[model samples]
Target: MSRPRSYDEPSVLSGAMQAFRRDGYRGVSIRDLEDATGLKAGSIYNSFGDKAGLFDAAFEHYNKVVLGGRVDRFAPAAAGISGLRDLFISLMHEPNGESHGCLITNSAIELDRDEQTYRHVCTGMDILFEVFLNRLAAAQQDGSLRAGTDPVLAATKLLALYQGLLVLVRAGRDTQALERLVAAEFHELETYHDARPAQQDIQA
Candidate 1:
């Protein structure tokens, strides 16, 4: 019979999650995880089954606690562009005070081997796209967007924008520069001006 664990599962996973964020999948070794989680190899193997299992747990934890948590803030913001701005600003902050980069985004670049991980990331992105697409449609209805602007296209652009920004942050771009870049994109959208003037018929 196996004895109950002395270590907390979530705590161990949370600590390993931080190490994964900092070292990345390929960069981190079994020894690295051991150091981060304070669990011996046998315990890790017995508790989580393997490194892959441990990583899968950690990835889900990061999504819910770090990345997905940002979406909860959307309800309070004005929605559409204002809510999007708040979301973008939140991305600049690191998860658990580790500025390495998004665990999902980082893992995304190395997802050639793991089907389960890839599916999770893909589903997460699709959920994000659906949420933003609806928000963009709402903005159009409220006249915050151009009368003829395509909500689908705008939402896709936003998806690209945030993902690209994460890579830039990982590349060590200056914080001021990152903020300025965000400001420039928002300024180009002219969101500060009153909702786009209604379109008028030009027929004679």
Candidate 2:
């Protein structure tokens, strides 16, 4: 019978993720992973196949465990505008040391030439955009957003703003500045409501 796995896969993967997040894929070596994960070369190879394989595993873990929780916070917001606002606020409030911008956005910048890695990153971005689009559509239907607002366009703009904020935060932008920037964008959403009649506002 095949031998059962001997090490703590989740723990090892979490360490690997930290290493990968600190250094892009090309920068992480087997020795680095070995030190980070406390797994010998042979053990890592045996379990995960190669460095790329281990990175893929770590990326998946980070996505589900870290980014996933933040995204989940917006899932219950009453409308797209609220959800988008909440999402930006969460990013601004992210703990100092834990703020590394975004793993997927970093991957996108570092792995653009690698088709497999690019595709994986693109899929994650697509899911985020789709979620925003769906929420925006719901807002439009309920009159919380203007009737003529293009859900896809609004989603794209929000995504750009969010990703840009991530870049700014990673560069050491002040937390208050980030908060103000996000609040300003959210305030613009109110203009749409202002154009609607008072009765429509009550229905929203």
Backbone clashes under 3 angstroms, per model? 0, 0
List, residue by residue over 38-147, the lDDT tens digit for candidate 1: 99989999888999888988888877776666776752336667777777777776665468667767877876745777765776677677767877788777878655
- Candidates' lDDT values, in order? 0.76, 0.78
Evaluated at residue 197, the lDDT of candidate 2 is 65
The sequence of per-residue lDDT tens digits that candidate 2 reaches over residues 48-115 is 99898998898888777776666777754464577678888887776666764577878888886566
**TM-scores of the models, in the order given:** 0.81, 0.83
Q: How far does residue 14 in candidate 1 sit from its true spot (Å)?
A: 1.6
Candidate 2 scores a C-alpha RMSD against the true structure in Å of: 5.5
User: For model 2, what is the error of residue 71's alpha carbon versus the real structure, in angstroms, after optimal superposition?
Assistant: 1.4
Q: Model 2 clash pairs?
A: none
Off by over 4 Å in 1: 74-78, 95-98, 188-204
TM-score of predicted structure 1:
0.81
